[model samples]
Target: MKNFTRVLLAALLVASFAATAQDEESPALSISGSVDAYYRVNLNGTNDERTGGTIAPGTSFANKTGFALGMANLIVGLDGEKTGFVADLAFGPRGTDAVFGSTTASSSIVNQLYAYWNVSDAVTLTVGNFNTFLGYEVISPTANFNYSTSYMFSYGPFSHSGLKADMAFGDFSVMLGVFNPTDLTDFNPTGRYLGGVQLGYGGVYLNFLFDDDFFQADLTAGWDLGESFYLGVNATTASDSFYGGALYLQNSFSDDFSLGLRGEYFSDQGVGAITFEENVIDLTLSANYSIGNLTIIPEIRTDIYSADEVIEDADGIDVSGDPINPTYGSNLSSFTIAAVYAF
Candidate 1:
């Protein structure tokens, strides 16, 4: 009888342990990503690089002529009740251009890798490399309505590696972070660091980033005008660098079709050249057609500069032996068609 009682007690203890384990929520793992490709053509310049310069705009992505691969992104995530981690990886030309500051081969493919802890219902802390919160556009093609990036986004910081805290209060939210200098995503070799702050209410965000040598202030907002029409606005000014404003107007015709227009006015403050001061205006129109997880974008873009000779023309050289490749008028135009698939 004593032996049977001991055996019964051991079984009961095991059962209780199993029941507790079943009641606790298990960590969930998820995988998702996107792939993109595009074809582009110059409207006023040579399509090839035989003239010693590419005819695309000065923006970040979708600049290559003919057919090109954008990137393949893979994001893996694991979430628990109070902790989570994300590993985002990318490959191809667009990804390489985006993560240009990553020095090592292993770090080059990593777009974002971070771990977060939920300190409370309204507060969270995250550490590691993550995308900057100041921009209206992101590095991911699937997220932006336009295939090509804006000059403000191209000049702003891409990613930051640091510690940040996000807190929320009703409709208001605040984020504060200390990071390595702009685009230094792997580690901080320079002793200087960057600080950032973002304040949000409703859908509008006011962001600021500052360091010893750089300071930028940005405003981003979005609104829905009707059942099918939406508008987005972004404006930024970086000290001694660049200042620009862009407006995004989009109308959805159906569940699978939408049209978007972006208009921008940008000014360069001799960032590219010692004596160059130019103001530029860009207008882009695009159509989005969605089928399941795939989206097709057809776009047309035109840029006008304040000064002549801003863009390279098809003409090769002048009679004075000076290169006329970049000696055309103040305007440049191009067309692009892109396909993006997400899952």
Candidate 2:
């Protein structure tokens, strides 16, 4: 009888410990990412790059002619109750273009690597390299409604390595950050730092970034007009350099199908601007069709420039087989079809 009682008590103690272990929250590790590819063609211009022909728009991604690979993104994350970390990586042409500012070989493959601490219910702090908060369109295709990027996004900062603090109060939020010089993700070599601040009310955000010699201000907002229709707006100006605005309208016809349009006006404040020497207007129409975790996007885009800046035709050889120059035009049009899968 004594031995039986002792055995039963020991078993109960062990069961209690097991239950306690199960009740405690343990950190979870997860994996998620996306892969994308596309086919593009110039409607009115030559598609061959061998002849020094510009394949597509001057945007960042999905610019390659014919069938081409976009990228494969792999993200790993560990989430805890009060802390978390994310490591994002990318491969292929689109990825390479996005991280062109990386100075080190090891950091070239990294898209975003950051850790966050939830100091309170309304405050959080993050450190390390992360995507820029100023742009409406992100570096990932899965997050953007259009596969082809915009001029504003192409010229804006892509990523920053820094520390940021986010705080929320009711319907208002604020973010402040200090980072290494724009896009210098590996290390700070210039010894100069960038300061950033963002204020948000409801769904509207006003952002500003400045350094010793550069400054940029931006506004981004979105609204749902109806159950099936949405509107998004973005405007940005860089001091003495460039300014642009874009409008996005989207309508969802069903759970699996939707259409969107983007219209933009971008201007270069000439003398020292990084873009073209003139102004440009871009219009893009795209449709999204989703099948499980895969989304297909077909897009039509046209770019109209204030001057004849687009390469319309380029033939390296003339009739007599001598080298000749390319022809320029005021407008360029293109079409693209892309497929993206997320997991």
Best by lDDT: 1
Q: Write the per-residue lDDT of candidate 2 for residues 158-209, one digit (tens) a residue.
A: 9998777788999999987777888999888977777778999999999988
TM-score of every candidate relative to the true structure: 0.88, 0.88
Q: What ranges in model 1 sit over 4 Å off?
A: 1-26, 273-277, 315-327
Worst 10 residues of 1 by lDDT: 15-24
TM-score of 1: 0.88
lDDT on C-alpha atoms for all candidate structures: 0.84, 0.83
> How do the residues 1-343 of candidate 1 rate in per-residue lDDT, one tens digit apiece?
2343234335433433343332225588899999999999989866656564677777898989999999999999987777778999999999998899999999999999987776679987778899999979999999999999888888878999877778899999998777778889999897666777899999999999886677899999999999999999999999968888999999999999999999999888866621223787889999999999999999999988787666666566567655554546678899999999999
Q: What lDDT would candidate 2 get against the real structure?
A: 0.83
Clash count for each candidate, listed in order shown:
0, 0
lDDT of 1: 0.84
